[model samples]
Target chain A: MNFEFTEEQLMIQQAARDYAQRELIKDVLERDAKAEFPADHIRNIAGLGFMGMMVDPKYDGSGMDTISYVLAMEELSKIDASVSVIVSVNNSLVCYGLEKFGTEEQKQKYLRPLASGKKIGAFLLSEPEAGSDATSQRTLAEDKGDYYLVNGTKNWITNANSASTYILIAQTHPDKKHKGINALIVDKDTPGISLGPHEDKMGMRSSDTHSVMFTDVKIPKANRIGDDGFGFKFAMQALEAGRIGIASQALGLASGALERSIAYSKERKAFGTIIANHQSVAFKLAEMAVKVENARNLCLKAAWLKDNHLSFGIASAMAKQYAADIAMEVTTEAVQIHGGYGYVKEYHVERLMREAKLTQIYEGTSEIQKIVISRDLLK
Target chain B: MKILVLIGNVPDTTTKVKFNADKTAFDANGVQWIINPWDELALTRALELKETADSCIESIVVANVGRVETESTLRKALAVGADEAIRVDADPKDAFYVASQLAQVAIGFDLIFAGIEASDYNGAAVGGMLAELLAIQSVSAVSGIQLENGSLKINREIDGGSQTLAMNLPLLAIVQKGIAKEPRIPAMRGIMMARSKKLTVATPIEVEPLTSILSFELPAPKASCKLVAEDQAKELIRLLHEEAKVL
Candidate 1:
């Protein structure tokens, strides 16, 4: 009903914007260039409550509304998508999933630390053989009395090397396919779990991503999330929430790119006047603004639906698809506006372009989102 | 030791001040409110004291005077790490009125903290008035405070420098910037916990504003700086001595 932000939400948004502009923006270029994670900045964000924006009060969370979470994500992604993902995965993917599905004991042991920003969390679903076809996973979990022996390799896992806890998806019964999928909470220090070398990424290099290999890793049965067959459902539900986060991140990246493009167009001179005076440059900036605004609206609508306990799966998927595509378009146009300067890393549009590409691929790929939308429409 | 912090919700410092058409009062149409910066220092220091001494400290209670807007600020105080918050629900228009309301609620607290001055009115009268009403020892402009047994060791600014004084428990102190840690952002978890924390709002006794607003206006523009030629050093010195009278 109310489209405008609440006073608390506005305050938090302003705080995030102020903090990002003051602390993150200054070093974002350097960190992206050198592929260095800003550990201190991450600590500062944790100190500011960005790390656990939606966590429940009992576990030391901000217990903020979902819209506030999206707002914070949008602000962070506007500065650097890599940092946003690190925060998003910790808040939405790992922590939210556990809190929603974990038992009291599990919450006390796993959710508390992650929600408190004391540890990092990762969602491990994609494997080399099963990227979109998550049900065809080769990873297996075998029940052995009190423990489940897990053995599988998950690739493209975000925060693999740094995460203290991972919500890992594996097959409990290979013959049952999707119905056999199960979610397991695995600690980073488990004996048979080893992290592969960090992936050499093209964008979002500040976010550490790699492969995780489990060689007969023994996990307590208590760590199993929900029922044995509910892993796929839980993973899908978590991704639905994650799609909204990605959409907000896309909106943020586009917004940042568009803002810079506008500022530059107005400042750069051509034919004895500012380039912004040219219809060509002016139209491009206008179009970029339109796309960013549309994407932001969609992201907000999806987040609002989820917060109100409505069925937002289709809306979330649609928003993700539209926002991701728009981000790519806006970032690419932003670079074009910079012309020769945009090609070089010195200008940041090139980095924005690179960052925008990942949003189309992660959470759910643009293609996967279409499938989700079409399937929902057909039903 | 029990510490009490007095919080206030003042117009956000960033908001431009405006006046009503009749010129009788300031326009508050779109003004945003925030926890007074000075009171944040008080709240932070009280929380710090509780953290360091653990069980030796009994509780950290925050008190405020205003409407529901004060509730959010109080929640923020709690999230920043206070144990509880109490709102004296009345819009006291002047320092003395607010202090009178707080004086009625100052019982059982060993140490009390408030901002040296509120940002909205810039009135530095609440601490002294509250102290006088409660008949307790008080100190203002306190830059540092520590608890020792049953007394408070206070470091305060004076005209030329700073001074240190010690007062027994059940005293009042106005906190300044250097008194404690800067306010911390309520983390996701802390924010969630604050929703369920103990926040009590009570009806305050009636009070009247002692001072009324006449009008509001912006401060005069800063005098422009003049560029003095390199060879005019002697002339500049003469101007400073004879014209500007700074000699």
Candidate 2:
């Protein structure tokens, strides 16, 4: 029943807020226009230990709780989602997977650097043919006596240009179907690994996303996570944890838009007085506030469940679906509230609106999340 | 050398000011609290000075004069790399009261830092009073400090320019902006370690306040701007000259 955050959590939130408002907001518009990656900012945040906010301290992480991670994500996402996505992937997918499943030796060599943010990591699951249907992975990892030979095309791979380590999911036995998949950690400097051109994305353009082609890439067998054919369950569990991060990002977008709309409405005058004095604009702001609050509650609930080691799959799915949808709705209303100014990049509502669309499309699409939730409820 | 940074707890800069019923106090409901901007910068500079290998800074301690709720602000100072905190359990009624309370715990520190003024009141008096109370030399409007050859090098903003001075230890520096480039954000490690950092609460000696506020009033709302058509240059000039009275 306690809603108040701990002193540490509040301080972390403030730190993230201060960094985003002071540092990230400085070049966000220019970065978005140029579609440039935030390399320096990434190093700076990693120095701040945001890249592995929830990893164990023994492995060079901050050893923070999931709730603190959610709070930091929300604050950072308020100004720049591109940066937040990198943080999310490294913490939830890369570091969490390694810490939870990797062998002691694997943790010592690979997880240490990744969790310390000395190196960045990426998760490769989706392909051209397998978007929502993850079981239809066409990428194959052939079993060899000493090592596994990996060959696959991973699409929409985030941090493709900058990451040094990748947690790759590929099929090892086609007859075993979904049970045949394995998740392996591969060094990006390995031979026969090439990356396609950075995709020109609609929003979050500052985030580096590309298609990675692996041609007979040799990976150590010791790098495989969990038992044989455990990659599917590992990826699913990681995604369940990752949904909290995305949900918080969406919440940030929604709340950021609402705040801008409120500020703009009070200052912007229309026919006779400020638009905020009008009932129409005021009601829209009220509705946006409600949506943002609900989204925040849902995000926090999912994060809390995860932190408590409770079953958070269904909760996270619901949060991701609701928050992403509401982010789009709220950002659109924020733009409408700004009148003609919302169409441009100056006031920042337009950029927030653009960023909101990706939250619904990435991680797990809204349709897929609905499937997860409905399936869980029926079962 | 041990450093003591005088921390001030203040409302966030973006807070919308609201008065209590009788207009004597600020409304605290929903107001977010933060470390004073200048004080944060002062702490940042202290940390930067400590980073040098040759510097003899042993630890940085932040002291505040406030109630229990101000512990969060003090904890934040710790999370930003201060070694420990000392809170004078009392209401910071006035600059004199605050300086008087701080002087007790601040006696042993080799170097002390005080922001020129708290953002809320802008009293601009605590640093000078503390120096007088402790009978130590004080520098005002200090914008920079560096440790050079075991001596303190200070850069202070003066009328129309700046001046650099070489000073000794056991001095109170009333710092202004440019003390550091930016306030340091607490890293995740610092946040975790802050929980275990020692925050000592000292009992405050009774002190009589030299000033009290009877009421508070906000400045009048700005008049709406009268925009003249771009083509009517003469009209705009006339309005500016007559109404604004700046010509």
Candidate 3:
């Protein structure tokens, strides 16, 4: 297998790096402290066609492959995961779902704007009771002939305040189990839609996260994706593709931490020389480097499988679990390498550690990914 | 008005410089190539001018003189919004040779831009040589360029201050930094479109090089820093006087 990246892929990576290092790193600390949404930054990247990088060019996307998407994600996540999560959800979940499953009319009306970066989109799936057990969705969408009335509370919804379109997943018939579920595209301006207060998150606070309450929201039947019972499969497939995005993000965090630790160690003097000259500190750096490299390989492998139209479910699950776990481990080591400075905000390793915690818990929790892997082996 | 940007292929800014065993050639085994920083800034300004409503600038073309490996760097310039590219199939032996190759393709453009120097060699000679060969007026140390009512308004750094000059077409600008805020990053669409943009490979004429490298050596590593305690004024003075020899 060829390990070299194409010229286009390398150029995309450089563009993302230029933007992240030059723009995002400027006010990241202040935004994190204030928990501010990166509104202007979102607009900037959207203009760069990052919001829909992998969608078809006919639908106003950049028509990039999944490998390019992974490279861009990793570069952007290195400086600001808060911004990268917004990009990940829009590209991997909202854009991919519509391009792969939505009808032509739906694509024309809804996907066009999102793919062109004219609007932001969100995926509404998780409820307060259904974090990891996605099959236990309690939100109800009552069938009303031409329109379906939706009423539910979706918890931890990212881009809740900033998105213009939402891909809502709800059950139409509780007795029918998952087969009764349907996914619909709903306008954010629809009446009877209200958002809860922004959750005070531990890290990635710059991302707009809130609980959305849908009460008697009417969505037309024309908006339903795939047949009447395709919501479960659609969500699963979308998340399977989405794991690559998060895996890359986690890889970025680990590598960013290691780079900072290396730079700090060489400059920080302890007894008589720089800390990097000490074997203890140097060995920790080596281990962090190894973990980051492994995580990168896993992420790229999963991306390659998806790009080549192969079955990537198990590979994605493995990547998500391993990358998320190592992100936490590497960031912790990075902090320890920085000694007392790592506990502070300016050093940035502390914030990376905080962000690493969320990667393990979201998309699919580490426990949930293990279940997916073990179940596949047993079958 | 059509604009032509003189592109130079150089190692990435962060690359560690290394020489071959004989010290007669650069060791380029793993060096990553990029557009010269000043040229990138010049291209950025050209794109900005083209975006204006009253712009007379029609299209921007980038030209480079190098072997096929430098095609990627040329393509990168196209990815950042150049309308087309031209590559002269030859090794750029020196500034005069590069300018000679560029002069063959740079004719008929209303305006030509060359960075003051390439990051690698810092020769600072191509733009002047090209202008002299083409029998056109040249502007040096240009930091700002704008088009006002179809005329070119330019800014250049003087000995103690800055000065602005107004010039006509068929001129070459030797640009320095501050030509633009920063080089524009290629958008995803731009990267995709770059694959289809026209990159013409022109035949190089026989030209003798005026200069050749004899040998190469890297500068010595920086001396270690010594810190003086806040209360140790006497020791600091003694060290600076005896060791540093500047007191």
Of 1 and 3, the candidate ranking higher by lDDT: 3
Which scores greater on TM-score, model 2 or model 3? 3
Individual DockQ of the candidates? 0.28, 0.88, 0.92
Among residues 3 or more apart in sequence or in different chains, the pairs in candidate 2 whose N, CA or C atoms overlap within 3 Å are none
Ten-residue region with minimum lDDT total, candidate 3 chain A? A172-181
RMSDs, each prediction? 5.2, 1.8, 1.3
Name the top lDDT candidate: 3
Model 1 clash pairs are A49-B187, A52-B188, A57-B193, A60-B189, A61-B188, A61-B189, A62-B188, A62-B189, A62-B192
DockQ of 1: 0.28
TM-score of chain B of 3: 0.95
Candidate 3 lDDT, A197-295, residue by residue in tens: 999999999999999999999999999998997898899989998899898899999999999999999999999999999999999999999999999
Clashing pairs in 3: none
Fnat for each model:
0.44, 0.96, 0.96
lDDT of 2 by residue, B25-49 (tens): 8898999999999999999999988
Q: Give a tens-digit lDDT track for model 1, residues A203-259.
A: 998898999999989989989999888899999999988898889999999998998
Model 2 stretches with alpha carbons more than 4 Å out: B53-55, B228-247
Candidate 2, residue A159: CA error in Å?
A: 0.8
Question: What lDDT tens digits, residue by residue, belong to model 1 across residues B151-237?
Answer: 668999999999999877688988889987666555444554566889887878877768877766768777655567999999899
